[model samples]
Target: MLKAVSLGPGDLSLLTPAARWAVEEAEVVAGYKGYIELIPDEVLEGKIVVSTGMMGEVDRARQAVEHARAGRKTVMVCSGDAGIYAMAGLLMEVLESEGLLKTVPFEVVPGVAAFNAAAALLGAPLMHDFASISLSDLLTPWERIEQRLQAAASADFVIALYNPRSRKRSDHLREALGIIGRYRRPSTPVGMVRKAYRAGQFVEAVPLKAVDVDKVDMQTVLIVGNSATRLVEGRMLTPRGYHRKYAL
Candidate 1:
């Protein structure tokens, strides 16, 4: 059996029990080098660990599938929820294309996604409706991403941005801000959380127009509040209609 386990966002404490158990029970573990390093040394001791660098996801998924086919319990490790722009979907596609989807039994173990983790640190900015969108155009086209951003912004949905910016994609976040700025107020609340719950964690809430794009990178998750969102005593919050449905 193969298990796709989410390791959470850089914090060992954020790892779910089922994810930890999947790793503990696996004979082989495969994932990107950075994510693998997040696991405790003791857990990987004496285990067949395969570490791959960036853009080697296909190779890593193939290795995990092969190991599972050979009767070795294997786990494909990913940061955050594996299904959310991670290895789970890729692994499934590979297995299906290779005619092994039904032959090999697999399960996905969920963990704290970056947006949820960042939202917790920033308070309840997601108390109302929200949408998550990735700014990376490596696989997805920038045009499609823009449409989604425009729709989410125009609808006043709280937006969680993943892969907001990177070294090679420095201008993407600024472009996204421009698109969102068309629909949202310049004073809209925006929360930025970098390396949430991990070492060197940084969290800040600023106005949408005042956001420092340079401070945002791929490791950060930015939550742009909806029209109903507010900053309450330094914390970001969005009402859940509790005030209207009942007296509070």
Candidate 2:
């Protein structure tokens, strides 16, 4: 059995029962070194661990698949929901390439995504329609990322940005905000959560124009609100329009 399990944003307590079960039942656990380290020593005890560093996803996926193919129970861990910017897609691709897509017993164990976790800390900023876009240009072209930012902004969709900034792409988040500014007002509420539900947690709601871009990093999740979103009592909220048809 091969399972792509999500470790949630952080905090071991947030790990889902299913994800924990997959890990406990697995003979081998593989994931990025950072995520692997999040697993409790008790859960990882007596298990074969295959941990890799940054940009080592392909190798980890291949090793997990090979272990599974060899009749071993294997789990590939991811930071958030496996299906969202995680190892599930890559594992599936590798399985298909190995002609084991149908023959292999595989599953994706879902957990809290960064956007969901961040939104919870920032109140209901996602009550209305929203779009999630990653600013990383490693696999996708910068032009394409910019196009998505433009489209999401012009459509008035609440935007959730992932991988907003990094050492190499220091200007990506600033550039993205610039594109969003073309359509959104400078006063739009923007929620920023760093290390959501984890240590060094930082949550703030600021106007779009006031965001301190320098403080944002890959660990941050930024939620830019729509025209109707507001900062109420220090919380970011996007109304669902319930007041339009029904009494509050």
Candidate 3:
């Protein structure tokens, strides 16, 4: 059997029970090296761990499927929920293409995604309607990302940005800021959380125009508030109809 387990951002405490169980029972585990490093030593003490660097998703998926086919319980790990910008879809596609979709029994174990973890650290910035967009154009076109950014900004939806920047993709975040600037005010609330729930975790909120794009990287999650959002007592918040409905 093959299990796709979500490691939940970077904290072992955030791992769901099902995910923990999958890891505990798996004979083989495969994941990006960074995520593999986050797993507790005891959980992986006797397990066959296959660690790969970035952009190794296809190879990792193939290895996991091969292990499962050999009658071993294999688990592929990912940070955050497996379904969101993670390995679940890629693994499924690989399995289907290899004619093992039905032959291999598999399951997906869910975990708290980065957006949700970052939101908790930044107060309630996502209390209202929101959209999550990835800035990385490696697998997606920059034009499509720009279109989505424009639509989300124009609609006044709170935006959660993933894969905001990288060494080779430095200019994308600046371009995204420009697209968002078209519809949002200069003083709009923006919160950035890096390495959430992990070592060297940092969370801060700054005005939209003052956001330090240079400080944001692939490990960070950025939240841009909607027009209705505000910073109260140093906390980013978007009221969820409580003022009108509850008279608070």
Candidate 4:
């Protein structure tokens, strides 16, 4: 059996029990090196670890599938929910390509995603409709991402941005903010959480115009408010319109 487990943003406490059980019961564990490092030492003490650096996702997935086919209980771990910008789909693709999709037993153990963790830290900014977009253009085209941002902004949906910035794509986030700026006011609320629930965690709420782009990186999750969103006290909030029908 193969299990794709989510570690939930490098914080063990946020990792779901099912995900931890998948990892603990596996004889072989395969994942990106960074995410593998986040697993508790005790849980990984007796497991055969397969780890690789950046751009090695396909190799890792292939190895996990092969290990599972060999009758070893194998698990692939990824930070946040595995289905969200993680290894679940890639593993499925590899399994199908290997012709073991039907024969192999597989399961996905979901956990708290970055946006979920970020939203909790930033208060209820996603109380209404929202869109999640990744600024990374490695696999996705920039044109399509820009179109999504434009649509999400124009539709007045709260926006959650993932992979907001990286060394090579330094300008993407700023450019996205620019596109959104055309639809949102300069004073619109924007909240950023870096390394949420993990070491060096940082959370800030500021106006869209005052965002410090240089401070953002791949570890940061940015939540841009909708037209009706606001900063209440220190929290970023978006109303659900229940007030329209209720008396207080």
lDDT of every model, 2 decimals: 0.91, 0.93, 0.91, 0.92
Q: By summed lDDT, which 10 consecutive residues of candidate 1 come out lowest?
A: 239-248
The CA-based lDDT of model 2 is what?
Answer: 0.93
- Ten contiguous residues minimizing lDDT sum, candidate 4: 239-248
Query: What TM-score quantifies how close candidate 4 is to the native fold?
Result: 0.97
Clash number for candidate 4: 0
User: On a 0 to 100 scale, what is the lDDT of residue 81 in model 4?
Assistant: 92
Cα RMSDs, all models: 1.2, 1.1, 1.3, 1.1
lDDT of 1 by residue, 140-227 (tens): 9999999999999998899999998866779999999899999989988999999888889999999999999999878889999998
Q: Output the lDDT of residue 98, model 4.
A: 88
Residue 215 of model 1 has an lDDT of 90
By TM-score, is 1 or 4 better?
Answer: 4
lDDT of 4 by residue, 158-180 (tens): 99999998778699999999999
TM-score of each: 0.97, 0.98, 0.97, 0.97
Per-residue lDDT of 18-90 in model 3, one digit per residue for the tens?
A: 9989999999999999989888899999999999999788999999888988899999999999879999988
- Alpha-carbon runs more than 4 Å astray in model 2: none
Tell me, by lDDT, which candidate is best: 2
User: Where does model 4 exceed 4 Å of error?
Assistant: none
Candidate 1 clashing pairs, residues 3+ apart or interchain? none
Stretches of candidate 1 above 4 Å error? none
